[model samples]
Target: MEISRKNRRLIHTIVFLVLPLTAFILFVGFPLYWIFITAFKPESEISSRNVSYWPREFTFANFGEAWKNAGFSIYFKNSLVMTLIGIVLILVVSIMTGYVLARYKFKGKSIVYLILLCTQFIPGAMLLTPMFIMFSRFHLLNNVVALALINTTFQIPFNSILMSGFISGIDYGIEEAAQIDGCSRVGAIVRVILPLLKPGMVTVAAYGFIACWNEFLFAFMFTTKQASYTLSVGLKSLIGEYAMNYGQLAAGAVMAVIPVTILFINMQKHLIAGIGAGAVKG
Candidate 1:
């Protein structure tokens, strides 16, 4: 007996796709699984050289300790507020800049873009000294407002460049037609352009939030006060001279990952819709 064509194809598919998919899943999911399980494990289990896949003992004390003793509660609130503020500013500025870059031609436009691109390659650590000095001079140190402003400044260049490409995908004829139908320039942009730009905006907003949320260097450097420290900074503070609490750290990480995961799941629908809409329009 010989294998049928269908059976051969099925074997090939399994070899080419299913095996790789399973491997990839295990590789990617293992760290997340380990961290999540570790968050529930007792300190003794976490420290032992003989590590088990399952927790020997589970406790909620880690989360409570993280929230209270580690100052994650304050850090979480500060991170949320700061990230939101940065995202808003980035969105507002990027939209206008992207629209202009996409729809208009002006002197130094290419040069401006080149500068923005170049700025992305510069080491943020290298800028720390000047930035700290500048902040100190302006009394902006240890301030969430200053942190938001710094995040916005660094984020805007890349985001605006990306949004310009997104804006270019939109048909300008719609805006022109709206203007012809008694819509003012501002109104045309507000009504026609902004609606079309929602997907790009959402995408950029998510990116901005993640960037600001994970940003440790600037946040660590600028925020000296516990009340102003972001989650990343606060997590770094969890490491002590003599004692390290792995469970509390893992719990804090899990807590931080949850909101971003929820947000991504929610926006995934819009991202799919955006792809479909683009395909239709194209």
Candidate 2:
């Protein structure tokens, strides 16, 4: 009787937990596996009516084609430059805004918070027309710097609030102690608070990097020239009106995934900690 009951419980656990987890893993993992294989499969294997689980012949032609012929090299460079610029702008502004909100009391603070919260609800599409006109008037269309600025504009409010929460979690006494020890306000922040805020900084940077890197609609709409196109826009270019290059598309996707994946892997620990701390204090 005892052995039967233990067996039943074990069966229940497997049914309720193990089965669902395995299914979910397959559901997500299979597509990634398919794409990885498809990227290496030759052009003939890709367009065939017959589907194979594995590539019969693997080749590097897709990556070469995408990089050189498809102009992804230019797109990749543009994305790198724009993302780096946007991340720097985001970090600087969000940190300062967060520090103020967390450490100082000021008039209109509630109103500012309310405004920031409201901006999150505003859809990106709604601002597209106005931004286009504004950028056109300034002759900033097709410019990477302008793209970075727009990305920074959209990213700031949420990041500021997130940074504020992180700052709130830190004890004010630390900054005070630094000030008492002959450091100026900026000096204390530079020398003391920033080191302690590494986790929050990593969290913000990861979010900012993803946002800037994956931005598509803005990059597509604002930049008409191929030279200014980011990776997301470049990926869309692989689809023709009458034909699409599946292999190149898959190769481009793999390239796009690599950087963000590496970043997340390296910063996973700090990101988890920062999010948890911010959530509790926020």
Candidate 3:
């Protein structure tokens, strides 16, 4: 009877834990595996009727062609500039907004919070035409600054709310103590509360960075010039009028993914830790 009980327990463990893990590994790993294999596959193998799971002719030639002919170097620099600028602006603005919302009690605060929540539901597609028109009126079309501003506007509300939660997690007394030591409100935040919010800040910054880096719709709409094209836009350009360059497309994807993947893995620990500490008092 005890042996039978152990058998049932083992079955439960496999069903609850092992099966899901195995499934996750396959789902996530398969795409990366596919891209990696396809990136190395020669054009003949890719376009052939018989598609092999592995590449027949693995080549470094694809990477060279992607960097040069695909204009990925230009795309890489543009993406880096836009992402960095947008993320910096987002964090700076979100942190301040979050601090005010979390630490202070004021009139209309709940209304402001509700409005922010509402913005989340507004589809990006809906905003595209209006935003394009607005930017065009200002003659900001095809500008990196315009793209960065648009990305930051779309990103800020959520990151601000997130930052508020991080701020709320810390005790108010710490800031008060800093105040007692002759620090101004700004100084207290910079010296005291900001340090404690590092984990949350990292999470927020990562979210903003990733969003801006991978954003295609706004990037595509805002910039018509190839010089201003981001990685996503550049990658999209790889799709031809007649025949696509799948190998170069895959190589560009792999190249585009490398920096963001490295950043995410490095900061994922902080991200998880920050998330575990919720913003709402409840």
Indicate which candidate wins on TM-score: 2
Q: Lowest lDDT 10-mer window, candidate 3?
A: 273-282
- For model 3 the TM-score comes to 0.90
lDDT of 1 by residue, 1-282 (tens): 999999999999999999999999999999999999999998788999999899988888889989998889999999999999999999999999988889999999988877877787789899999999999899998888889998999888778877877899998899899999999988999999888888789988987887888889999999888888898888888775359889899999998888888887888875555445433432
Off by over 4 Å in 3: 1-20, 272-282
The reply for model 2, stretches above 4 Å from the true place, is 1-3, 272-282
Model 3 agreement with the true structure over 28-102: per-residue lDDT tens digits: 999999998898998789889998998888887778898998789999999999999998999999999999999
List lDDT for all candidates, in order: 0.87, 0.89, 0.87
- Give Cα distance to truth, residue 176, candidate 2, Å: 1.6
Name the lDDT of candidate 3: 0.87
Q: Clash pairs of candidate 1? A: none
lDDT of 2 by residue, 74-114 (tens): 99999999999999999999999999988889999998888
Predictions: Cα RMSD each: 3.8, 2.1, 2.7
Best model per lDDT? 2
